[model samples]
Target: MADDRHQTPASGPAPNTPDVVELPDVTRRDLVARLMKIGAVSLAMALAGGGAVTTLTTAIAAESTKSERKYRYGMVIDTRRCVGCEACVVACKQENKTPPGVYYTVVLENGFGERPDDRPLFLTKPCFHCEHPPCVPVCPVGATFKRKQDGIVVVDYDRCIGCRYCLVACPYQARYSDFGENYPAIEHDTPWADVPSPEYKQFRQRAEGKSPIGNARKCTFCLHLQDENGRYDQAAGRWPACAKTCTGKAIHFGDLNDPDSEVSRLLRERQAIRLKEELGTEPNVYYLV
Candidate 1:
């Protein structure tokens, strides 16, 4: 059983031998076998090294691509289009059934001075929905978080123990603690009994009216609107009610990732700014100066 790698070549004459380059047939065959074995070993080593390099390169490239992916969900509010219409404020109140004093949306009126020629500008204010939301840390319970999947700050109502710490911690004054109350006259008009929407979409029983009824709530960026089914709705040209009801079309909502999307284009083209930019909360919501 000759080793496969050392198998001898077929027998032939070994009579001729030059004086200067004298070598027996058996010696020549042995030398040839040794060279072939070394070549095979070198080839195997080269292939193994090449394979390792290729695998590592591919892995590193994939990681670099993933890490370079920017994930800052944001919005652009065009102040020029805002016409002091409280439609967004009214729509939000209607959509969320907010108590008389608790408002999820408001308009800040900036007056240049009281005079005939004085100008008053209206700024639509909603949850800034900060990237590093301050509300997340103050909660004794793990109720609030910025979702890594989409960067939308959210409050888990079930986990919220009606503590208003988040409400106070928020710089934008976003959170609102719910009070169990409903207009007696509008009892038949349950806002939750309609098409899909975040304001009234997912409902569970509040514990003896202590549920979300007493828990804090805030803008969710219309979470339901970000779902796959919602995108299907958007493709058909339907948007969230607040944006749909804006007569001036001041509010724009779309994927921040798609560079060509309306929001993305506005961010690039306008002198957009977020509220309290100095704090470095990195609010996703932006306002056009």
Candidate 2:
């Protein structure tokens, strides 16, 4: 009999025989390219997910920081307690040593109503230290800015050009332009002239041509009296001069952000109003009607 292995089948293959298969040739470059494409797609997906996570984290942190502000120094003035006296004005001047015609605080009589029979409402007006201060953005030289730590609006006298732009921009008329005027006691060659002003802790003395003489000035909430941590010790007498000197205890100053602070309690207990609320200045100062 003939060998079965050498015999040829009439059909493609025998029923019990296995068939041989041929595959297309693959190169090293092709394998590498395919792997690289898969890797790139994975990396792109990972990066997109990572970027989204990072953005979410940043937004959360910003919101948390805004809600947790350390201090918001503000005041709550009781209109009933104010007696139309100008003691606060005098105290502010003495503490800051401001020049004539430049009062950091003022007492406005009959601010609420002008009826002759109606009782006069004496309002003690100071720099409101607005959350969105218009004077800060209009400064041509960036001399005025709001402090982030305590939300106090302050002026950099050294950077001021005495342009008076900030004065015009302020809706509250809180800014003043110093035109080199002096009082009799602080006149040149006088004893008070040699005395240094403790404003911003600079302790600058009056001179013929110097800073603060021609610079725009405003109230700083008497920050110079604050300690290094921006804290005011009421018992230690390190407090705002205007608030400390109010004879009737009309002015209540403290960290408004503190839930247990005096100003916060007054706001919760009494009906308070801020000046120019329509302008959206969001002033830190509030008046209890």
Q: Which candidate leads the pack in lDDT?
A: 2
Which digits, one per residue and each the tens of the lDDT, describe model 2 over residues 28-99?
444334334433333334444443433333333333333455688999999989998889999999999888
lDDT of 1: 0.60
TM-score of each: 0.66, 0.76
Backbone-clash count (model 1)? 0
Q: Over the stretch 97-203, how does candidate 1's per-residue lDDT look in tens digits?
A: 55555777777777222335466677877787675678876777656666554556676666678879989999988778777765543445454433232353564
Steric clashes per prediction: 0, 0
Candidate 2 residue runs with Cα over 4 Å from true position: 1-66, 114-117
In the order shown, the candidates' Cα RMSDs to the true structure are: 23.2, 26.7
Candidates' C-alpha lDDT? 0.60, 0.77
- Top model by TM-score, which number? 2
For residue 33, give model 2's deviation from the true position in Å. 49
